[model samples]
Target: MTDVRLAERPELPDRLPLPVVDNHCHLDIRRDDAPEVALRQVISEAASVGVDRLVQIGCDIGSARWTAAVVDEHPALLGGVAIHPNEVPRHEAAGDLDDVLDEIASLAQHPRIRVIGETGLDYYRTGPDGVAVQQESFRRHIALAKRLGLALQIHDRDAHDDVLRILVEEGAPERTVLHCYSGDMEMARECVRRGYYLSFAGTVTFRSAKDLRDALSVTPMEHLLVETDAPYLTPTPHRGRANAPYLVPHTVRAMAATLNTSVPQLCQALSDNSEHVYGPWS
Candidate 1:
C-alpha cells in the first residue's frame, strides 16, 4: 500500500488536452497506506493532468509485487523490477535475492512489466565496501533484462564512468534508460550517441541547474523523456511540497524552455520516446 502523505489526490484542471507520461515514480512506496486507496489517489491525480500512462519502479522484492498489483488495478500504470543499490546488501545477506529475482523474472512476463530496473551504481550513497555487491547485483539485473529483452532503467549517481563502462562492456539491452540523468553535457552527448534514452526529472527546473539545462538543450528530442520522481524533487511552484505524478507538467515546461520548443511539441516528443522505451502502456 502507498503512504497517505505520498498518495493524496491532486486537483486537476477541468480541461486537460495535452498528453503526458510519468516515466518514473515509486507508487509502491506510498507512505504506509492501503494499496487500493493509494492507487486510486495516484490515478485520480495523474488523470487530472492528462497523464495517460505511468511507469512505477519497484526497487525491491516487496515493492515489485506492490508495483505489479498497482498496475493490475490501474491499467495506465506499468512496473519495473530490481533491487536498488542501497538495498542490495540486505537482500544479499538475507538470502532473499534469489526468490526476489525469480519472482521479478516471472512478473516481467506480464504485459505491464515493461522494464527491469531503477538499478545501477550509487557510489555517492554507498562506500567502497558496497561496490562489489552493487556491481554483482547490477550485472545480474542487466543480464536478466538482456535475456528477457526488457528495457533496463538505470539509476546512476556519481558513478557515470563505471556505469557506462559496465553497460558498454556487457552490451546492455538496446532499450536502456538513464533515469534522472545527472551527468555532465559530454556524458549526455555520449549517451545519446550510444542510443540511450535520457529521462529528466524536477531537478531540471531548479534555478542553479544551468549545466543540466544546457545538457537538455543539446540532447535530441527523440532520445528525451521527462518524469517527476515524485514524493521527491518537486518542481517550482511546489518545490518544498511532496511531489506527485501530477507535477510532471512543470518539468515538461522547464524542458520545453530549455529545448526552445513549445509544451505540446515537447510533450509529443517525450511521449514518443517513452513509448519507444517501455512500449505503449496506453
Candidate 2:
C-alpha cells in the first residue's frame, strides 16, 4: 500500500462504515516535484477511509500520460483521459489537439483507463474567441467517446443547456456521467429520466448548498453517485484546503441525509450506480 498524508482529518462515524469510490479526481495535478510520494500519500489516505477505487482524470496530453502511468502502478486507481474545454485553444493552436486526442483514444484501450472526460463546455469562462473553440472541441470529444463506445464524463460549468443539447444531439454514449453535478432539481430529474448518472462532489456538503441538497433529495438512489473531486472540493471541515479522496465519505453522508437514507444504504447505491456507469471497479 502507498503512504499518503490526509488533506484533513475526517471524523469517521462507527455505524455507517462503507466502501467508497471517488468517481472523479485529478491525481496528475498533485506536486510533480515528487509525484511518487504525492501519489503514495493520496492512495494511503483514500484507503484509510474505505475508498477502494479512484478515477484519476487528466485534462491534457501530459496529464493524461501521467495519470495512465499512475494507473499502471496502482491497481486500485483508474484513469480518465480528456482535454478540458479551457485548454482547447492552446492545444489546438499548438497543433497538438489531434495528437492528444489520438493518444487519449489509445490510452482508453488500457484496462485501467475506464472513462473519457472532464470534457465539456465552460461558458462561465468563455470569451468570444474561446466560445467557438470550446464548442468544437467539446463536440469532438463527445464524438470520440461515442465512437469508442466508452463511458463519457462531462464537466458542465454554467453551460447546462448547451452541454445537454450537445450530448442529446450527438447521441451521447449510453453511459454518460455528469461529474460534480451542479444543476438544480429539474435538471437532476431530467438526467435521471434519461438514465444518466449524477455524481455529487464536496460542494453538496457545504451549508450553503440548499439547491444541491434539494436536487439530491429528489434524485433516485439508483441514479446517484458521490465523489470528492479531490485536490479540489474538499467538503465541510476540509474546505479551503486541497481536497482528497478520503473526504468522499463526508459527501456520502450528506447525500444520505438528503435522500433520507442511512449511509450504508446510500453507499451501496452509489457503488451500484458507479459500476453501472463506469463498469466494474478497478
Candidate 3:
C-alpha cells in the first residue's frame, strides 16, 4: 500500500534510450495520490519518459467494461480482462460466478481486447476453501484464451506450484505471460522450458528480491517482458509512493543492471517481447 500522505509523485526517470511497453498496468485503479490519474495525463507522463505503450488490465467486471470501452479510444492502450482469483470467492459465494463469467466472455469479444487474464491462482490471499473455484476459474480463462486466439496473462502469487501444475493440465495458450512473475530459479527454468514469458515488475528492483532476479537471470531475453503492475509494486527508490506507468524506466534500469546488459539492449528486448506477446498497440 502506498503512503497517500506522501502526495508527491516521483519525478519522471531520464527517458529510456529506446521505448518499452509496460506489459501490465491498471490505470483505472484509484489510489490516493491521484485518485484517478486522468487518462490523458497517464499516457502523456508515460510517453514523456519513453513508456509509450501500455497493456492495461481490467480484472473485474466494472473495470472490464471500462477497459473494453477505453481501449477503443486510446491508441496507446491495449487491454486484458479477467475475474482475478482473489475475487473468485466473492462471486462464487453469491452464486454470481456464472453470470460474471458470461459477462467477461462477451466483453472479451471487443476488438481492442487482446488478452484474457491477470487470472490464475493466488493462495496467499484466498485459503483452501477458495481453491476449488479459483482453479476452475483459471481453467475457464485459459480455455477462453485458446478459443479466442488471444494471449493469457497469469497472476500467480504464493501458488506457484499449483499454478504451474494447472497451467500444464489445462494446456496454456500460445502466448501465455506470467505477469509480475515471482517464482524461483527452478520454477523459472521450468516455465521458460514450457515456453512461457515471465514479466518482471518493480518488485524485482527490491533488495530482498535476489531470488526474483535469479529467476530473471535464466529467463532468455526473448522470453523476458517488463511491466509496472502499477498503483502497486512501485520500484525501489519510489517504493512507498503510488506507482504509475511513468515509473517503468526505473524497473527497466534495474533489470538491465541485474542482467549485466546495456539499458538500450534490454529496452529493445522488452519492447520486442511486448509486441510479440500482445501484438502491436496500433
Candidate 4:
C-alpha cells in the first residue's frame, strides 16, 4: 500500500443544499491516521454533509477485489474495476496483464460493479515506450465496458487528444466519463458534444485553475458531475490537508459559483447526472 498523509483532515464544509454523489474516489488507498477508522469516518462525515453516495474505484487486482467486497457492505457505495493506465506497463512487464484483466472481467459481473474504469491514457506518467501498452489496455477496457453495458470512467492526464482519438476510433461506450476533467473550454465543449460526462474534482477550486473554471462555466448542468478523487486534489482552504468525500461540498459550492447557479440547483443536477451515468445507487 502507498502511504498518504496530510497534516490533518479538513473540517467538514457546510452541509450541501441537496444530496449529490461522489462520482469518483479511491477509498481503498490508505490515508488518514488509521485507514479502516478513516474510511468509516469519511463515509459518515460525507453523509452528514449530504454527499449520500460514492463510487469507489479500484485500478488494480487487489483494490478491485477490495472494491467488489466493500460495496457489498455499504448501501451507499458502488464500485468500478480496471487496471489504471499508469499500471498497465508494469503488468505487461510481468506477463500477467492478460490474466489480471480476465480477473477484472470476472469481477465486473458483480452486482455492485456499476462501472468499468479509472482507465485511459496518461502521457504525463508513462513514457513513449509504455504508451502502446497503455493504449492497448485502454481499448480492451473500453470493449469490456461496452460488452457489460456499464459506465466507462476515463483517467486522462496530459493526453486529452490521444484519449479522445482512441475513444472515437473504438466507438466510446454510451456512458463515458472524464474523471477529474482537466481540459479547457474547447475540449469540454467537444466532450459534451459527444455525450460524454465531465466530472470536476477539487482541482477546479485552485487559483491556478482558471481554465478548468471556465470549462465548468460553459458546461451544461446535464453533462457535468462532481468528485473528490480524495486523499488528493483537496480544494482550497484545505489544500494541504487530507481530502475525503465530506470535503466534496467545497468543490460543489465552488462549481456552483462558477456556473452562476445556486448550490441546491447544482447539487440536484449533479445527483441527476450521476444517476444518469451510473444508474440508481440502490
Candidate 5:
C-alpha cells in the first residue's frame, strides 16, 4: 500500500500546443520511501505532454556524480553540476569542500553537462557564519561557468540582494539563469536589465504569487524560461503532490493566463530560450 501510494503520479494533462523544456529538475533526489522512477518513464511522460526536453541540475556531490553518469544515457536530458549553497558549509565542515569542488569541475567537463550551477546563496536555511563560504562557492561556480562557456543556473532563496550583488562582483556567465525565480518586479527588472534569464517554477501559479506574476508580466519573452523544480514547488491544483516534469502544463497554462498570451506562444518562447541557454539536448 505504501509503495502503491508512492507510485501514484498525477494524471497527465492535455498535451501542450507546442513542446517546452523543464530546465531545472533534480531527478537524483528521491524520497526514501518513493519507488524508483525510471529515467525512461520520466522522459516519456514528459514528452507525451509536450515537455520533450529536460535539464537536470545536480548541485550536491552525490547528485553531481549521478548527473555526470546518467546525462549521456538519455538523449532527452542535459545536466548541470555544482555544490549547493546549503551543502557548502557542510562540505566546509567536512574539510572536503575543495576536493568536492574539484570533482564537480571535472564532472562539469562532460559534454552532456551544459550547465554550471543551481549554485547561489540560500540564506533561508544557511546561518550567518556560513554566508561567506557560501558566497565564495557561488563565486567559484560563476567563474567555472565562464571558463567552460556553459550556462549558469542559480538557486537563490531569501538572498536576492546578496545573490545579485555577488553576480555583479564575479560577472555572471553569458547565459545566466535564475532558476525558480522568486523575486518581485523590481528585482526582475534588475535581472532583465543585466541580461539574466528568469526561469519560473510552479510557485508562480499560486494565488499569493501576484508579485511573481508581476515579475513575469514585465519580463521580455526572450529572457523568459520555465522549470518544474520537481519534487518541489509543484503547481497549484496539484499542490502538496510530488512534482515531475510531466506536470509542467499546469504551470505553463497559469503562466500563459498571467501574461495574457497564448499557451503555444509561451511554450515556443520557453523552447527557444532553453536552446539558447543550454544548447541542444540532442
Candidate 6:
C-alpha cells in the first residue's frame, strides 16, 4: 500500500508531441509497496506521455547500488551515483566515509552510470559543524566525476556561494548541473556564465516559486534541463501527490507556459540538453 499521508496519484496528462527526458528521479523510492511493479508502471506511463527516458539518481550507498543494477535491466534509464549532503554527517561518524565513497567511485565505472551527483552543499539541514565534512565529500565527488569523465550533478541548498566557490576552486567537471536549482536571477546568470547546467524540478511550477521562474526566463533553452525528483517536489495541481515520472508532462507543460513557448518546442530543447549531458540513452 502507498503512504496514506501523500496525495493520491494524479491522472496522466496529454502525451507530448515530442519525447523529453526526466533528468533526475528516484525510482527506488516509489511509494508503492511493490517497487518493481511501480517502477515498470511509471516507466511505461512516462513513455506513453513521451517522457521516453529517465536519469535515475541514487544519492546514497544502497540506492546507488540499486540504481546501477536497475539501469542495466531497463532500457529507458541511466544512473547518477553519490552520497547526499545530509548523509555526509552520518557516514563520517560511522568512520566508513572513505570506504563508501571508494565504493561509489567504483560504481562510477559502470557503463550505465553516466553521472556523479546530488552531491554538493546543503546547509539547511546540516549544521555549521558538518560543513567541513560535507565540503570534503563534495570536493572528492567533483574529483571523482572529473576522473571518470562523467557529468556532475550538484545538490545546492542554502550554500550556493560555497558550492560555486568549490566548483571553481577544484575545477568543476566538464559537465556540471545544479540539480533542483534554487538560485535567483543573479545566481542563474553566474551559473550560465560559468557554463553550468541548471536543472529545474517540480518546484519551478509552484505559485510560490516566482524567483525560480525568473531564473528560468533568463536561462537559455540549451542550458536548461527538467526533472521529477519524484516521490517529492510534485508539480502544481498535483502538488501534494506522490510524484512519478509519468507526471512530468504537467511540469514540462507549465515550463513551456513560463517560457512562452509551445510544449513541443520545450520538449525538443529538453531532450537535446539531456542527451548532450548524459549521452544517448539508445
Best by TM-score: 3
For residues 1-282, write the lDDT of model 1, one tens digit per residue: 445544444444333357778999886554334233466777777777877788999888788888877787777888898889888877777888677778878877877888999899999888888899898888988998998889999999989999999998888898989999899899999999999999999999999899998888889999998888876787876665567787787788889888888888888888888888888776
Candidate 5 structure quality by residue, lDDT tens digits, 4-114:
444566789999999999999988777545566888998999999999999999988989999998987999999999999999999999999999999999999999999
Off by over 4 Å in 4: 1-5, 32-36
Per-model CA lDDT versus the true structure: 0.83, 0.81, 0.92, 0.92, 0.91, 0.91
For residues 1-282, could you state the per-residue lDDT of candidate 4 as single tens digits?
433446455677899989999989889885555245356777888999999999999998999999999999998999999999999999999999999999999999998999998999999988999999999999999999999999999999999999999999999999999999999999999999999999999999999999999999989999999999976788887886667889999999999999999999999999999998988878
Deviation of model 1 at 103, angstroms: 2.5
**Looking at candidate 5, what is the lDDT of residue 98?**
97
**lDDT preference between candidates 1 and 5, better one:** 5
Could you give candidate 2's per-residue lDDT for residues 1-282 as a string of tens digits? 322334334454233377778899887665222233367777877787778778899888888888878888987788889988988877877888788778888887777787889899887776668778788888888887787777889999999998889888887888889999999999999998898889999999899999999998888888888887767777886676667677787788878878889888888888777777777754
TM-score of each: 0.91, 0.91, 0.97, 0.96, 0.96, 0.96
TM-score of 2: 0.91
> Model 6: runs farther than 4 Å from truth?
1-7, 31-37
Worst 10 residues of 2 by lDDT: 1-10
Regarding TM-score, does 1 or 5 come out ahead? 5
RMSD of each: 3.3, 4.0, 1.5, 2.2, 1.6, 1.8
Where is model 1 more than 4 Å wrong at Cα? 1-17, 31-37
lDDT of model 1, residue 222:
95
1-282, model 6: which lDDT tens digit per residue? 455446356788999999999999998885654234467788999999999999999999999999999999999999999999999999999999999999999998999899998899999999999999999999999999999999999999999999999999999988999998999999999999999999999999899999999999999888989999987898988887788888888888888888899888999999999999999987
Output the number of the lDDT-best candidate.
3
- For candidate 6, the per-residue lDDT at 67 reads 92
Q: Mind sharing the TM-score for model 3?
A: 0.97
- Summed backbone clashes in each candidate are 3, 1, 0, 0, 0, 0
